[model samples]
Target: MRISVLCDVKPLLGEGPVWDVRAERLWFIDSLGRRIYRCTADGAEMRAWTVPHAIGSMALRDGGGAIVALQDGFHAIDFETGELTHLVDPEPDKPNNRLNDGKVDARGRFLCGSMDTGESDPTGALWRLDPDMSLHRLDDGIICSNGPCWSPDAATLYFADSFTGEISTYDYDIATGAVADRRTFAVLPKDRGGAPDGATVDAEGYVWSACVFDGRIHRFAPDGSVDRVIEMPVCKITSLNFGGPNLETLFVTSMAEPPLPKYPGDGPQRGATFRVEGLGVTGRPEPYFAG
Candidate 1:
């Protein structure tokens, strides 16, 4: 499958593409530019919200507001009024740390991770929130945490440290918030280039991973094998989703940084959203915090 940019958001980093099923819209974040955006599914009406500071990820809440993992702390973003309310900041004194990637699990609890803002230190971790409003730090010493997506059967969990080039799988016990039997699902091979950015699972139990340097996305099987690859024109493919009526169109998000010279048909394609004709199974909708 050929992946291309379907829409554009200019920033040092663009991340988090969550699909809002109720509103039929796609909400994502431009990390360093300090903005949150809501766009129509067709890549029109791109509206942005200027955060007081940078935000790593944002998702819908069970109540009325949005939950954002910000550089300063975890903020409750009021959807109606656009006000940011502080909720929590686990590491308030760690000025070099910031929240990175996150997603809501099947049980409606938000799972997120953090990494060093300096981009060198490994003082990061994975966190979990219980449905009963309890919180726990799941892991430690992580760098550039990415996807925390669950399998279609809900028995496995996949997470990535973008800087470390490791995607690990765990035997997930959702009821108890426990992960054991850890194994390397895919190493990503740092020598081959590209880090695993944002990732999701299709109904077929394939992990669709976005790449940072290789201008493509990878589809990895449940048994830890490369099933296929989707190439893109832009080098930084940050996030993606399976949207549209049939949920077969793979919606991709990209940035404008090109490692090489621009080609002829590269005007609006770079930093723009792109969709392939036929891809993905009957996939699950991207979840939100709903907390």
Candidate 2:
């Protein structure tokens, strides 16, 4: 409880922080600072874009622009001319692999993930982004496919495979995305450095996770227990969302390095960007022009 300071898009891998209820503001990225962040709602105006590669997630595309998932492929981020174009690179030939965490399905499609820049084992996979943009891989080796939410009547599908700390639950059928019943749903505690980064499911279905490096950001409870534990002073927090104007305010995204080699940014909660006020929860809206 009690978190503030939403205005630093240091973004050296800020992951994906969303809250774009019809352009109210807040769009994120920093994945290696390839850039992509547009704030407002206290954070004032920020706007950014430098992406050419290395951007692990993004959504919110229906008729405008946004549906990035690059690291190697899957693009379309024209916030209104900033353009990043090029939509179709799925594996391009597997130049090592990238494209992590993503969301935008309630039929709008655009669910993503594709790890393995040497994230230990399991090559990684999980995708879907049809609407002529074409690209459907859906589930694969998966070694680190962080959160991929979808469950506000989208049937039920909330994933995570950050090395497998468990956070599963699937049974969707949103017209065709199909994802039969799974299990676990929330297991955690694998020595504690935690992994399950980025996840969402509010409006009552609680299942908000971040946990990366154990800084804290949890709220599982749909039978999986533990219903709230937002701490995070910063240890590499990767993503989170639920913006202001009634969304209950809660938007975090940290990462000051620490992929292990160390010696890159030092740390101050890594790359900043946080906020957590009255987080009773309320976020579920953002899915546009699937075309």
Candidate 3:
């Protein structure tokens, strides 16, 4: 596979790369930078807007604009007016927790999780925002949440809690938006030097996960066996997604500033977004948040 820098602009904490099928564009977030960016499939015509608070993740809306999981809660973004309207805060009681990684399900429900700002306490929970704008809690007691994706049939949900070193799967009920039968799907031991970060599933049902400190991207079979591993040039690879006209290109995001004390030696391309091609695999179009 061929991998190269997608753009020159680097973000302090780049995460959440999403491909807009309708717009044929790539959208991502600079979490610590408090900025949202969009660019053409070829990494041109890039545009950005700043948010009032730090954003963890975002998804395009079917109607228009987008929905963002900010430090406070979920907000609706008006691209035309640059207005951010607060929708709801699932965990107003826990001021120390902030919303983190999220993805839209096949039925158009937005699923996101929260994480402790200090990254020490398990004060976070996974939440779902339905099309009606109502919120539902799925799981709790998470230290850091990342990587929420679904299987090909939408019957299984895969998620990761970074501090736990395990990626878990749940039996997902698409019609009711409920998750059960939570079980370990994969594991990245602490000795391996990385934890699971962001992830996406391919059209063939294989899951691709980014190893944050390990500088590698792993492809896992449906049985949770490691199929292949691609080492990255940068050290702190944060997230990745499949984009491009036919969804053949893999777009990756990374972290730069506030370097981890344990994992040092970040290269010059530490925070740059990367474009990977020739993977010989394609991805399904991510669904727009119906809300």
Candidate 2 stretches greater than 4 Å from native: 1-15, 18-27, 30-35, 57-97, 102-140, 148-183, 186-206, 209-222, 225-247, 250-291
In TM-score terms, which candidate is top?
3
lDDT of 2 by residue, 219-258 (tens): 8887888877777777678778786667777788888676
The alpha-carbon deviation from the true structure for residue 55 of candidate 1, after best TM-score superposition, in angstroms, is 1.2
TM-score ranking, high to low: 3, 1, 2
Query: Regarding lDDT, does 1 or 3 come out ahead?
Result: 3
Q: How many pairs of residues in model 2 come into backbone collision? A: 10
Query: Which regions of candidate 3 fall more than 4 Å away from where they truly are?
Result: 259-261
Put the candidates in lDDT order, highest first. Answer: 3, 2, 1
| Candidate 1 structure quality by residue, lDDT tens digits, 1-291 | 444445766654667877777677778777877888888767788888888877888768866568888888678888678898887887777888988788888777788889887667889988775545567888888867888899987789899888778788888887876788877899675544778888889879999898876676888998889998877777667777677666676776666553223322234455566666566365678665656
> What C-alpha lDDT values do all the predictions have?
0.76, 0.78, 0.92
Question: Per-residue error at 268 for model 1, in Å?
Answer: 6.9
